[model samples]
Target: MPISLDKVQSTAPGLVDLAKTAKVSLEKRNLFGTRAKVAVVMDYSGSMTREYREGRVQRLTERILALATQLDDDGAIDFFVFDSTAAHLGEVPLDNYAGAVDRLTQGRRMGTTDYAGAFRVVRDHFGFAPPKLAGGEKKGLFGRKKKVEGAVDVALPDNLRPASEPVFAIFLTDGAPNSKPQAVQALIEVSTAPIFWKFLSIGRESFDFLQQLDDLEQRVIDNADYKPIGSIDALSDEQLIDALLDEYGEYVTEAKRLGMLA
Candidate 1:
């Protein structure tokens, strides 16, 4: 069961409405009793400076925390940020999530976007090995050969690896990554793991690549979904919750069918 409403009311009163609404949505989608680890990957590239400064990132974190309260027993979200590289900032609990966005990002210089680097961080954090390419080298965008980290002679897909629980990761980005092929390969590598990635586009960049990932093949199961939020400030609480969870039910069903979720 999700954290009680009285608990949310006392712990994070600001999130009471969001958590209540999310509960309804979860029940509507038959997800009321489901359990999963919640995580958020924020974009810290140069383009996201305005978002951080304007409190939009903080707002987004709050909203995600609201949902996390309903999905995670610990009432916290695993946090990560990526620019040219990535790092885990640990868990942001409901009691201490108000200023997490600015507090966690302070002093970090924004650089180019590197999705693969962040993807690798998340994959390794969950104890999954990187997927090995068939020919020893994987060609990325423009057919250029790329070297991936943590690759080895493993013939089994990483998806077949044992995972203790399902992870629901929200990957928010403003624009495309610096390397498209690397990002694509990284997603394919973890396609079989017990992780469902929901890519939320927070700008007007069209997010063509993320959309393409929805149809990415060669995986044991479809483990991703993408939605374009355009502007986070303009979306209502109900709308934001819907965008975050609309496709989650299907992913859960598929994961259970494949024995990734119990």
Candidate 2:
């Protein structure tokens, strides 16, 4: 995935005159596409019962349900609840989230938290386009034999992905940890794809677990050879998750339009 300065200059000759343009091309090789399969992980332990620090106590699961409802033909979404064990929130070929949320709501739930259990179940399920790495330096999305730096929906390893499509892992946690490194290492074995582990701090008291949570964050970032892209905070169920999902959807749609998702 080494940069081809000459190719960039040729593709975008107009930018060749810019300073340092030869060092790094502006053809935008860092783009994503629509075919991504998304996995949503939630913490459903007894500790998560408190308000999400932002004053949202009652019907807390409803907020997450609302986020799930936003997912549809856009991509594959697997909802999971983690406690002393991990439970699949819905059946496979699970397309719409609204119904899935309802079904999960009906399922009895209660227990101590086990982050490792969740990782064991869903980590390996994702099929992220491996970022191109050469001699260890990351290039961009890993997929497809054709080398188009801007191609977002690049193919992925069939053994790792659903069939060379866009893939993602979204982990929602109260940032509480029973076993730190072990839980994450297990997840690495479960799924070697790009995972966006979001540590959603559940309540004011939950903030005490931030360091443990940060350690887990570093675990993924350090192993993946990249930085984590989320934070722990008083939960604010202000449709932010939905907004981000929508943003991703828009990007995929646009990428598809530009032939990035193909």
Candidate 3:
């Protein structure tokens, strides 16, 4: 259905409900309207130092960072930079994250890979509709949620409903998570929305992991694409920022369409 063109003004009893009303008018195409919340999870492990391409080899980190800079998110961005653990480096309007992609890349690395742990941390901030959940089932961030009465009557589209809310995520990592397999499994099973992973093979990312994710494609949404730059020697400083922004903008647009997000 076409979104309502009129401004969706409201003083609803709940923020989520207000967002639902506003979403009706934001059915813009290709990210033309407002976007919802999005988080970019970057892996800063030492393994990212591997160089890829020919001659002037560039590290996966730099190449990935370049793509992040090109995508424009005039909305809000939850940018998290992680190593053994994760931290919300900055939260800002979309432009702020785009502008700061360079500064974020300059962060010192501790050379650790805790893929599972980092995901657990990122999951704390946002909520996504769980996959395979009936169009009615809902989940909050970190498995915290209270079932609603008559939720089945909400009438959300299958793709736009609780299982497909736009609270999307991009996991940009060099290798597999050092954390327990079970931990990652639990997060994946219960996350609020489809988790779109963007893998960057910085240094020997476990081939097994990639295959494992591929296997999960049916069970979960494997939106996590890969950018294998190998190492930093190949990418110029300029190229690094461009790549990151380009992809980041795409994530922002997708998030806005689902009511699960802002």
Q: TM-scores, in order shown?
A: 0.87, 0.48, 0.48
Tens-place lDDT digits, model 1, residues 1-262? 5799899999999999999988887888888877878889999998888998899988988888888778877888989998989888787889888888777777888998888877778877877656555444323322223333443222345455455568888999998898887777777777656778989898766687887766655444577878898997878988888888977888787677666666
> Which pairs clash inside model 2?
35-166, 36-166, 37-166, 123-191, 124-190, 124-191
TM-score of 1: 0.87
How many clashing residue pairs, candidate 3?
Answer: 39
How would you order the candidates by TM-score, starting with the best?
1, 3, 2
Candidate 3 per-residue lDDT over residues 41-102, each given as its tens digit:
66666654432113122123222322222222323456677776777776533223233544
Would you list the C-alpha lDDT of every candidate in the order shown?
Answer: 0.78, 0.41, 0.43
Top model number, TM-score: 1
Candidate 3, poorest ten consecutive residues by summed lDDT: 5-14
How many clashes in candidate 2? 6
Candidate closest to the true structure, highest lDDT: 1
